[model samples]
Target: MNPVLGQVPVYNAYGSVPALPLGWVENYTPTGQPYWFNTITNQSSWVYPMMTSKKIPGTNWLFVLTHDGYEFYYDRDSKTSVWEQPEELKEAMQELKKLEEEEKLKKEEEEKQKALEEEEEAKKALEEEEENKKRVLEEEKEQARQEVKRIKLDQAVDNAEDVEATEMTEEDIMWQLQQMAEEEVGMDREEEEEVQEEAQKEEEIKQVEKKPELSEQECIEKFYQLLKENNISPFAVYSVELPKLMLDPRFSLVPHNKQKNLFNKYCHELGEQIKKEKSQNTKKPENEFKELLESKVTTKMYWDDFRRKFKNDPRFKALSVTREKEALFKEHIRNNLNKKNPIEDYKNLLRHVKEIQKGIRWRDAKKLLEKYDVYHAIEDKDKREDLFRDYLDEL
Candidate 1:
């Protein structure tokens, strides 16, 4: 048996005369010029006594003479034959397998070619899409540029037309001025003639006295009207230019005393408004606290130090009330000492005293501490002596 090509050395059996190596009958002329032969037998090595066959007319049967000279009838209807040699079968199978493999390779190549074409088509489509996008963007940009250019051109043309229509040349301006001067001269001559006529008439009739000018109240109201028209604040009564302002003919009737009284009333009103604003501002706790902190009184300075620093300050001077000053002093002390017992509070204060005298001579620091009654804190004689020596060495 052959595993790859199935069974080899296969044999065929007909009916039972005796089994022989299979041989095929052939068509031939009487001179033995064979036309067709089909056999898988080893007939060249075996001595066959005879071999012959005759096709039965009108039927698919043959009378064959076997190698042993036995006459047998082969019925083609039975379909028994080993007509091909082993080598020929193998060769035919190999050709068929090669054809199948070639067909499979051809199909795979065709599929790969189709896929490549599709990929190329897709790439071309993508490139065309990008090109279209870029073209649209460029067209939009061109349109926008053309729109801006059109706007600028229109503006330039409009400006040019305006200049041409209304702008005056130097010669034209000079001619206009000359014409105005001539008209003024003619008017002056007419006025002179009228004055002469009026003078002649005055000699014929006595003139009545003119009524007195508008009174001070009316003058002041006119002055206020001018100020309102000019948007000047009414509270500007104390402006340095008040005398110049009074030079207007309307204000000429206003007595100086009345003006002084008016200015003083406005000044008082302004002061009252300022005081009201200040009081309102102080009513807010944040504003008051901010002012207190900015004074640097509570956090950075002892009461005595704060008083020493700000004694001349108007706000500090306003602390003249004894109760308020005492309360301030108590707040300062409480902030520094918290709620500690007297002994602890005094010790804390001594720490500040030590800092104040840090660079002074030890003897001087001791004298200062003793002046402040630091010794009263120590009842034990030895501890007091030790404190005295410590103070002396502090510098």
Candidate 2:
């Protein structure tokens, strides 16, 4: 019979075999028989044939046959060869799964820890904010308590004075009554009439003294004096201070309806006075600060350098608030350093004055230029007038 088609072709030794194909390799069996193996398909056979296989759809797997005649699958992508499935691949897959689970657990634990830390930080910030609020509230409470105590003390003093006055009046009345009784016991008819008339006159005097009235203007002045004596600020709340003010006997002299209006008016006047005094006080320091800047600072100098240079100087230290000092420094730079020609600016402003004439006095010219900012650029009135004179001569 003819040889079966595709029968095995055997080789005796490795060197006896022809050069293997690109994807085929030569191997030896236990009997020293040469065999052909396909690396891509994971197939082995004694016969060498040009064989091809289709890849699994959407996969790198191919159906392969082992040398032992067992069916298996081969992955060209991962290069995994197995009969059924190798125990090592399964064990490797299990190990890979375990590693993924560990990584996931580790990430989750880290996320939980991060979330807990954020929560703790937020809780700490909230607690600190609450503590600050509590501290401020306690401070306000203490201040209010002190104010109430001071008011009570003032009221107590007023009450004591009134009580003493009342006792003195009662003692005086009793003494007068006893004198009248003694005079009546020893008097003739004419003397009795005199004593009776005198007693009537004394009663009228006591009634007048008990109900003495003050003029409205005097009452207002008295109340104002009381406010001054107590050192009450113009910013003092009317409702809050009313109880303290009422402790003064003069507070009752004014009619209730007019009292509020009077209090508002007095506060307004006091406010204006305080404002004027504060402005005056502020000017001294501002002037000193300006002089210090002019003497020690240069146009090239910045605020930090100037402050460092003269921080210990009395003129620099005169301005207490840092912002105020910074503001003045900025203003000085804007007015003096930034100006290319301040005198020329002043001249231009004077040129715009329609009321200025050739022979106008410096005072009249100053009044006209007072409305212009450039006119105030020069701090000294005399120097400004001198500059105006120079400008006039130029004209």
RMSD of each: 51.7, 40.5
Residue 246 miss distance in model 2 (angstroms): 7.6
Off by over 4 Å in 1: 1-89, 165-395
User: What is the C-alpha local distance difference test score of candidate 2?
Assistant: 0.68
lDDT of 1 by residue, 253-337 (tens): 5564465456556456656877898987765533433345355654334556655776676555554564566455545444443
lDDT of 1: 0.53
Give the RMSD in angstroms, all C-alphas superposed, for model 2: 40.5
Candidate 2 local lDDT, 1-395, one digit each (tens): 11574533322322343445567887899999988887766778889743233344445565544333444556776655444544445554455457768989999678556645654566587679968976796687567656755775677568556764444578766875685566446544544675578669868977864735778788788988888887777766566566567645677677765776787888899999989998877768778888898887664456778778888999998889998998777677657634666677777767877777688898888777765545656677888988888878976
Model 2 TM-score?
Answer: 0.27
All candidates: TM-score = 0.21, 0.27
Q: What local distance difference test score does each model get? A: 0.53, 0.68
How many clashing pairs per prediction, in order? 0, 0
TM-score of 1: 0.21
